[model samples]
Target chain A: MTHPKTRAPRVARIAGLVLVLLTAVSGCSSPQKWDLTNITGIMPQLKFTLTDQDGKTLQASDLRGKIPVLYFGYTNCPDICPTTLATLAQALRKLGAEANAVRILFVSVDPARDTTAVLKSYVQAFGPQFIGLRGDQKELRYLTKRYRVTYGLGKADAHGNYEVSHSSAVFVFDRKGDVRLLGRGTDPAKSYTHDLKQLINDN
Target chain B: MQRIHWQKHVSISGTHGRGSMMLALLLSCAVANAAPVPSVVITQARVRLLPGNLPLAGYFTLTNDGSAPVTLTGAISGSFKQIMMHRSFESDGMSKMAPVAKLTIQPRKSVHFRPGSYHLMLMGRQQSLSVGDTVPIQLQFKNSGALTVEFKVVPVGAQ
Candidate 1:
């Protein structure tokens, strides 16, 4: 039979374990103070099989250990796409060497116009970390639907030019490929830099 | 083109009791002879050139200094085959661009064409353009004559 004094110590030990477990659980549940919209666990993990700028098949696992910042746009887009990419470039510039671990995935919604060659030069202008991806209608639709984002191509004009409308949201995924933050094309560069630094440090 | 020049001296300091009154009177007089003042002044004109022959966005501010409002019908550039005015906006969580047929600037007011706002979409490049190159784009105005403005080509990262 255990002594009463020994039983008391066992009860205390069990209480201590419970306290540590509670702290861990709360830490996971508590909201992180991010300048951008915190989307941790609210969105699915980054999963897509698309054609990279080099015309090679790219799987999500290829970027498993790197944080991916995904944006939907087209090469012909004059305003929003370039602006968004430039904004991300500015943010990454603030990260210094830390920017090496971040990859920007620019998925072209208008795959018809944004060919592999066009997408390659387009993203390379922004930075070395930028990767332009192109997918067919089925692949694009599936990936966009998974993220609850929508993209539409306007009617072609007489010159065979058209407009492509897409979501401006910039999705930042963690190193584990889990979506963590949602930002906009109009957000200041500092906001992205702040969240990216925190995310990089955390993981 | 005839230009309006302000010959009258106007006080700018608020500490003077008659500064506001004098400025108002000067403006009234200036409006009477506003025909000599340029109807539209284009400032901070720049073109953001993307990679390849991708469509570029032109940004500038059109300030109407005349007494009458001026309408910008369109723009044309020898370097680009097609130039269309477009406005970028966010609606329902989507970033969209809509073609703007005509944009009117009120008298003494300014209209800014910048990123994520009113801009000129220049497509189908007829000639190669690089950073620091200047493209002369004529701004077509309704009723008033067109004005040739030089838009400096900037890198994609330029806002």
Candidate 2:
């Protein structure tokens, strides 16, 4: 027969296990505060048509139900654009299975060079799920103008090498195509994932 | 090539037997400091072609080490009909791609070749390239001349 005093430790162990299990189900550890949800002031309504990597036409409205993470840049950008997109890739990986719930779109303002094939291979290099889109400059104008994203071609320097400067902001759209958050420069993967998760939870 | 003068302070006329060894030591030290290789060495060069209407893009990095200023005044490769240095920029809701004739680097500075920015445009590919693969790129430098660097292929969502 076990002594009643010995039974006390067993009861305590059970209680601790139950507390941890309950806490996990109750979502206590993941104190997600989505920092970028206040996005009304940044981006506006955006809708346009563009060619995918396979040269097939795809529309923004066609991506209605899923969350969209969009940014504008050209294929020739040397620094900020690439790094920013690369940083997003890190954040996506950190999202793990939740990454499937999101879509990443790289819309090119330099429509002349960022053809369907250019975007296809470019985005394909990043991940199987990544998508690149480009259209005529006129179409780009319509789309970017709505988003309030700033972009322009710089003047030629002494070497005749013209530069293209564009906005570096990454816009997050909720499942309903409404702007939800805006991410700025150079944040760690954990911060991005936390923000993304919080955004998902809120939606 | 300038060979190092390794003669020790010992007088050649009345020096001990160790004079020759001492000269060798001095020469080695001097040679070590001259033209030290950059910390970011571009080896096994590979440049990827850009698809679409735009030219191809190449990925590479500059390592810095010694004190010499290294400048890459564009590059030329044989993988396509033409290979030139290009940079992308955006402004006023417009983005543009143009050729870059030169890229200069000070001592210990690093330059990265990434998407949506400075990249090599491989035009009119002679053959198709596959993902998860790399191609040889002969990097022509204004200072170090030409050195080959290999680029690791990754997906668009690659980190």
Candidate 3:
């Protein structure tokens, strides 16, 4: 029974309220600020104590103050391991002296086959600065579970011929030892370099 | 075909003139066309140099030029104690290597065995191998017979 002019004002008021509500909802669901997928809080604890390429027992805490790029792979991995390590080497080469600020950790999931000496030579072949880490199956399992890494061994024939499947993503940790970014094995070296530079600047 | 064509032209030139030359040219063309082409070709054979006792990775490209498909059953290399075909795959962030029993290539197709995909795992080096060294590997195929190809040893970081 209201006048048309009065009803128009009332409808406008309701529309204005609806518009404000929509803006609030949209703002609450805003996209992340970083280019890479944000996995900041996914893994809260990145602690581990494993043996390095030098056969020395090292703790993750020992690598503080330097950004660590972690990868889970084995030496016998003819494809992904070499490819990923090569990509990382390329990125480090592009960074030049800045590469020293970052540490590359190649965690061998195949502890049975990849010995410290084997890992040392394998990782050092890519870059002398690269550190190879390996541990027992239980220790590796704990670390893999903490980082959500999955790895399994293929069935071996009579000739001791088998393959190990593992995760290929490179987990980048900041100087503070917090997981920051994830780099894929297939990503170009430039992307890794870019991310590392940004992380260096941020840290 | 070229040898036969040359002999035919020489005899024809002694007997006849332009007409005989044209006939000889046509016959040579037909013979050349009928010649069998190479059914399979291997290219880009290279091996990665990994230090210590780690297995080396060999990569190559196999091209089939025949009308029928070809299956690569296995490979043998005297330089390594064992050679096996393997494929690398990544799914849901997990990277895995699986044994490739046999790979079949379609007619007129090529299968690339590159890094992070398919490769030959050469294990237990028989002798010390270094960069610039050439290792002979024999590829066994189902239809195209065995092909012995030389895989040049490349640096570990080389793609």
Model 2 accuracy (lDDT, Cα): 0.66
Cα lDDT for residue A196, candidate 3: 85
The DockQ assigned to candidate 3 is 0.56
Give Cα-based local distance difference scores for all models. 0.90, 0.66, 0.82
Task: Write one digit per residue (lDDT tens) for candidate 1, span A157-180.
Answer: 999888989999999999999999
lDDT by residue for model 3 (B1-159), tens? 001111223234555788888888887787656542336777789998887667888998887777888889899978888888988887777887778999998999989999888999888899998899999988887644566788999997789
Task: Tell me the docking grade of candidate 3.
Answer: medium
Error of 3 at A21 (Å): 27
Q: What is the TM-score of chain A in candidate 1?
A: 0.86
Ranking by DockQ: 1, 3, 2
Can you tell me which runs of candidate 1 are displaced by over 4 Å?
A: A1-31, B1-38
- Which has the higher DockQ value, candidate number 2 or candidate number 3? 3
Query: Can you write out model 2's per-residue Cα lDDT over A63-177, one digit (the tens) per residue?
Result: 7776788888877654456656767778888888888777888998777767776787678756655789888877778887787777777776564435566776778887777
Every model: Cα RMSD to truth: 9.0, 11.2, 10.0
**Candidate 3 structure quality by residue, lDDT tens digits, A1-203:** 76998999999999999999999999889843544545776675468999999999988899888888889988877778888899899999999999998989999888898888888778778886599999997888888988888888889877786778788778888888899887788988888888888888775
Q: What is the TM-score of each predicted model, taking all chains together?
A: 0.83, 0.59, 0.78
lDDT of 2 by residue, B11-38 (tens): 3344556876787667667655543332
Candidate 1 has an lDDT of 0.90
